[model samples]
Target: MSAGQVIKCKAAVAWEPGKPLVIEDVEVAPPKVHEVRIKIVATGVCHTDWECLYGTGKGMKFRPFPLVLGHEAAGVVESVGPEVTKFSPGDKVIPLFLPQCGECDRCQSPKTNLCKKNWANTQVGVLADGTSRISCKGQQVYQFLGVSSFSQYTVVPDTSLAKIKSDAPLDKVCLLGCGVSTGYGAAIKTAKVEKDSSCAVFGLGAVGLAAVMGCQAAGAKTIIGVDINPNKFAKARVFGTTECINPRDHPNKTIQEVLVEKTCGGVDYALECVGSPVIMTAALESTTDAWGTCVIAGWSETEAMNVVVEKILMGRTLKGTYFGGWKSVQDVPKLVDDYMKNKLKLDEFITHKLKLDQVNEAFDLLKSGESIRTVISLF
Candidate 1:
């Protein structure tokens, strides 16, 4: 494989909104300047990818049809375009949807991880050159989040890639690209969870479970997992949850009220990973009044969050995190290194694995809450 060459490979394409992905042979063009082509080995099925396939109320803001949907992935560098010097063929890497362009204002800031240059292109679903490298049956296909790892081969900007150690397993590190990092970073980075403090995670999905792991790693004495599904509690405990609460169990009381009562006032930290504005509000209100911090790590399509004026006035801090507040170029590789050292848990998050042809069934597993993370094995 070389630059400017067209490679035919199998990919899951979204022909229309609210429809199952079609597995077809798509043409992946060679990388252009400052871009690299990757042979994706594995990709995790994330909620963001699912929401993009099924149109959100925001109306195609993210659900661009005829797009190759997927972002959280790990693969090998197949080829590099002109002017590319950092990576070469055979290098293992992960595609970062939230790229780290060091020259951008956000990248330079220590407080944020978002890159301005790549963030702008994220909305258009195209490469930095304002064009796509995927096509099928003579029709152009848009790249989702620039990576589009649902395809066997894809082109990505050099800045949007994180080279990892060769020994790292692609099937496992792929989860760190998004959900795990987002949830873990929300606890250790955004909220700065403290030792002996209490924390609450308001979802049992992969991201929420990662948050639980983060709190435990931070030495939090009491970790509470809240979800409507009780089946998830066992899995949550595997990640270090001290207690589990099903909101449905307390039908007469709000989740916030139950949380407040259980923690004696409220938890020192609350994380909303479900992406519902309702849950976001509850997480905030459930935090201890005079210093508790709440982090919103979920994505909501159309929900508008409403917070009481006094909530912030009383000293509660509310923050939003993207990609776990991690600098992809710098931090993702370190996360992989952490996993290699057994300091982070990745294998436990994967509840099911399927081939690319079973991609639709992966989504069904996620929707039914039967799996923590469904990995699509491209190889």
Candidate 2:
């Protein structure tokens, strides 16, 4: 394929909410100004993608259907749009749903990682130009997030990709695009977990395990894993959870109460990877009253929470992270380097691997909570 030429490829598109994705041949238009076209090799299926496809949260349901829904992916730059100077063909890259347009005020600030470029608009299913580049059966298929790695080829703004080392494995490092980055950064950057501090990560999925890894890497001495599923305990231990607690095991006391008692007060850090508002509240209450920190790493639902103001009044900190509080273009490549250096683990997060045609089966595994992450090999 050449510049300004349309490319034809296969894509897994979800035509309706709560439905399986269909393998369809799609037409990918050439990237416009400041956009880059990528040929995705491998993509990781995440809970957010499943939520978008299942249409559970209002967060992702707003994106129109007949959509390509995979955000955590690694690919090679196939072409660059006019006036795009940062990337070229053959550069190994990871598409970032959270873009970093250097021109924005937030991009210039050190206090925040959000770029006010085209985020709000992209969530509505269009790119910077208020249009989509993917089409199937002569109909427009909205892109999922900005990555849409479920497709063989996708076009995203140049600001929405991070260039990685050429020798890195796309199949493995693809995870750094979402879950790994989100969770690991949640503990390392957002929580700033200190050495000898105590941490409780609620949820044992790939993101939670990544958080566990982050806590361990940050030198936290007491890392506790909390989940209802005991089956995840073994896997969580491998990721550095010193103790695993099944909430159901303590029937009489609240999970937060159990955590407070176990820590002799409350944990120094509580990270919630579960999206439920109740769990969010519990995680906050599980923190040390004087100097406890709670970070909501999960994308929460629209439901209102009845938070006790006393939780914050006692010097407790409650906050949340967007993309793990890391600037996408700047930090993602460093994470890739970490993976390359063996300082991070991505292979363990992938529980299953399947072809593009098995995309529905991947979703089924996700629905059953039997897989941490299912990687789809687009080749």
Candidate 3:
């Protein structure tokens, strides 16, 4: 690959959310130093993509309109940046939206999910070095979540690319890149769920299902799932949820009381997977009287909550997680291995596989509760 090589390909552009994913021809530039080009196999359409589409009350930091939308994905490395050391052409890789510069203090620390310095550019939806590698009709199109796997090909930082075994199906493993990792990490890593513990998850989307699976793997004896959609219960149970609640069924019931009754007390851990502030309140209030942990794992723009702070006065801790508090460099591959070993349920989470042209339909299914995950099969 040379400097001026322009690889023309198809991409799903998000001119607006409710509008369809505009399909157009785009130019993917050759990889720069420390970057790699991937022929995307599949990309998972997640709620984060939806949020990025319709600016969730919290204004998007990434600039407006005429942008490619998507993040969660897996693919094969087609080329490498000049200085890239860890990967080569033909390697199977999963793109991490939050790239990590291994030498950064935050990456060195066990607590944070991101490498502060490496992400300065990705936050703006450009390449890490300050410019974009993808453009359309000569205009620099915004790269949503850095990877922009909505395209037939995507260029990502080497640090953002994790090499996985080629044997694993790209479609299933791609979900692990984002929602699965976020939800699983929220329960297994951030919350540090204990065996036989009582846990309640406040959403039943893909991430919520991943959390439920993580809670089960961590040996949680009681797993309660809360969701607005009653249809998610069957799927949640397959992911290890022991009980399910539809908010509609408890119209007059308080979230706290309902959870208390379900768990025989408050839950040992409560996970808020929905971005709503009201749900966050419910998560906090649903925890056990003391030594309970409430984890806010939802990607939301809501800031204020109707909270009674006293509910958490009894040694209950409110925690927030980013990518499940996972260190991508370490955890991503482990997740893949777990999936391959059948230790984690990956297949159950996927509800649809779509082509780039059908990307917007994927979002519609997500919003209408018609699908748990919609994967864009670029291959």
Candidate 4:
């Protein structure tokens, strides 16, 4: 617990692709310059983590193995290195997988939330220093998404830390780190959904549900939830989905056809929460002609997202977002505050909670489409 001192702790390490994680003792090197060490209290299992583990996508197949893989996490700062002025010991914070270097052009521009400088290091699973902070039995373990909350303890750049209120429940607010924020922001920020407008959301996972909640918050009159699984409809309703449609029920008709017919042409806004190229195309096609806006919130690692050029030519806008278009360090704290005030629904998103030992089981729940968000308690 002092600066520059290594600490040994438990971490769920992914040894290889398509393999269960192993809870092993990991040596976490103390904060280097401008870095802060955190004791992870809770983390959420995200689909992106699962994709990183088993996805055969271009960059995903080549990801460095023996990596620690949880990103949506909330923790208390245990130590801070030299030149770290933003946070101190005992401060509650969420580690941002997307760090915000305010000096970057992307950070300075109002049009984007992506910080251009720190993002390159995330591709290689190294820190800003171009090295790993975790080691197991003298072998290096790469960090995942820069946050790497799978470990009981993690070290991140000071710029990556989003300090929140001390009393905020780490277990619930941890969802704000990714899913909740990404989904909710896709509606409120990216799409800027208008009041009483019709909206269609594809997929019913945590991110999709959050998108539903966001559309409701924006006062959308007709919020339609589209998913292949009927079981997800009940929970999707609780999150403000006014109508539910299962593609399985309409086998004769395409999902986009059903949605467009149901909405009397097409919806005002269409949000694609599923990372499928087919669904991405359908989402675009399901929107109202001339004015419909389609926001791609899901992260699709595969190469081409083919859509008819005529779709855009007809005045339908296709846009993509990262982290829901919210600047992480600047906006995540406010989201935590919104959750505390009951303006945001965090508890409803958490369908299961498990201990660190059940990390693989959490992934199973996600893969089986049985849980909305499974929070892993590291404490």
- For the record, the alpha-carbon RMSD of candidate 3 to the native fold, in angstroms, is 1.7
lDDT winner between candidates 2 and 3: 2
Q: Write the per-residue lDDT of candidate 2 for residues 1-379, one digit (tens) a residue.
A: 4668999999998898888889999999999999999999999988888888775565544568788999999999999999999999999999999999887889999888989678876887779888889999999888887668999999999999999999999999999999999999999999999999999999999889999999999999999999988888888998999999999989999999999999999999999997778899999999999899999988755665568988899999998988889999999999999988899989988899999999989889987878989999999
lDDT of each: 0.92, 0.90, 0.85, 0.92
Q: Number of clashing pairs, model 1?
A: 0
Q: What's the TM-score of every candidate structure?
A: 0.98, 0.98, 0.96, 0.98
Question: Worst lDDT window (10 residues) for model 1?
Answer: 55-64
- Residue 250, candidate 1: C-alpha displacement in angstroms: 0.3
Model 4 / residue 208 / CA error / Å: 0.2
> Candidate 1: where are CA atoms >4 Å away?
1-3, 58-62
Mind giving the per-residue lDDT tens digits that candidate 4 earns over 1-379?
Answer: 3667899999999999889999999999998888899999999999999999988464244689889999999999999988999998999999998778788888898999988655778767888789879999899899998889999999998888899999999999999999999999999999999999999999999999999999999999999999988999999999999999988899899998998999899999999998888889999999989999999998776556779999899899999888999998999999999999999999999999999999999999999999999999997
Please estimate how well model 3 matches the true structure, expressed as its whole-model Cα lDDT. Answer: 0.85
lDDT of 1: 0.92
Which stretches of candidate 2 lie above 4 Å from their native place? 57-61
In model 4, pairs of residues that clash are none
Clashing pairs in 1: none
Q: Which lDDT tens digits does candidate 1 get at residues 1-379?
A: 3556899999999998888999999999999999999999999999888888774565235446689998999999999999999999999999999888789778889989888665666566788888888999999898998889899999999999999999999999999889999999999999899999999999999999999999999999999999999999999999999999999999999999999999999999999998888899999999999999999999875668989989999999999998889998999999999999999999999999999999999999999999899999997
